[model samples]
Target: MPRTFDGATGPVAGRFAIVVSRYNENVTGKLLQGAIETLTQAGIADDDIDVAWVPGAWEIPLIAQRMAETGHYAAVLNLGAVIRGETTHDEHINRQVSLSLGELSLVTGVPMLFGVLTVNSLEQAIHRSGGNVGNKGMECAEAALQMVRLLAQLPE
Candidate 1:
């Protein structure tokens, strides 16, 4: 069953750090917009959100990890898009970035939401970024908010 967020007794307002990749500008740009919109809608003040830019997908994890460990933000959002190419390089990057971000979240105990999109082509990435598949950035923002609330309730 799907779990529902109980915002009445948890941390609902806090700082957020978003790390975005500049590689796929078009798709990533749209994703960033979606993420910001979702965060705003969730009652997070604009000034409380911090946005950082990285060169590409592989760099997202490291930046996000640093931000998550800073103890400033309630959560960190990692946004990137890795589209498959003729070479196998895409596979390696996708795996490394995804795994690294997951490990960072576990090690830091901070909610690091994975907003990376691994797709076969730019078109597919676009579709997920803000098209038919729905906006992954918005989804990531929602996940972050929910996680922040949940984490606040955990026994310290």
Candidate 2:
């Protein structure tokens, strides 16, 4: 069974940042839309949510770290798409970005959620980005909201 957090709730009424990648614009754009929509639906005000664009997946971690360090947001979401090519470059980028983002979340204690999609091709990326498999952005938004609630319960 999948994990759920229906009982989780807290003061996530304002201030969230989303760092999105410019690469794979089409895919990333849809992801952005889904994220924005989910957050809005969850009662996060438009002005309270900040969106930033980066060059690609490799930049997600750095941008997220900066956003988290600012202490201006309850949580940060990292969005990107890394579709595999003939070379292993995609693998390296996917792994590095995911790991770095995870570390950023731990080091900052700011609840950074990874929304990057590491797929085999553009088609696969599209299929997951608000397509057949559902939007990863929506999933990420939910994760960010839940993390914010969880962190709020932590002793600070």
Candidate 3:
């Protein structure tokens, strides 16, 4: 049988970085809360999780790249909200940020998660931040920890 290395689900034992977008503070704030709660519940210390606020979803990637390059954080979680507007600006922002974050993770060998909420309306954004659809921030934190553990198990 081919062997598969599965990441362990538990508290991450290293520093963590969270980049948040202030564009939709009401919504993003909820996501930030969820992410923090998840990390704390998983046994991560409050002091270990660092947070940075940027103007909007468009700015998450570069900050994440910088945080990843520092090698101080085990993983970086990006939380933002880009609600669609008349010009389809949200679509562009979402795609570019996702792509950039993906490339950063690949090149830096750091685990970076895109937790930004791309929705057609504020209602939909609210739904995912911590409402009906469930919280994506918590999921991001969990994913970060999982990836950290998985990387630790790999040959470095």
Pairs of residues at least 3 apart in sequence or in different chains that clash in candidate 2: none
lDDT string, candidate 3, 1-156, tens digits: 976777875435899999999999999999999999988888899999999999998889989999999989999999999988899777888889999999999999888898999899999998998899999898888898889888877776
User: Taking the candidates one at a time, how many backbone clashes does each contain?
Assistant: 0, 0, 0
How does each model score on lDDT?
0.90, 0.89, 0.90
RMSD of each: 2.9, 3.3, 1.2
lDDT of 1: 0.90
| Residue range with the least summed lDDT across 10 consecutive positions in model 2 | 2-11
Least accurate stretch of 10 residues (summed lDDT) in model 3?
3-12
**lDDT for 44 (candidate 2):** 94
lDDT (Cα, tens digit) per residue for candidate 1, span 1-156: 966546434348889999999999899999999999999988899999999999999899889988887899999998989999999999999899988988988899888888999999999999999899999999999889888887776668
Top model by TM-score, which number?
A: 3
Error of model 3, residue 67, in angstroms? 0.9
Candidate 2 TM-score versus the reference: 0.92
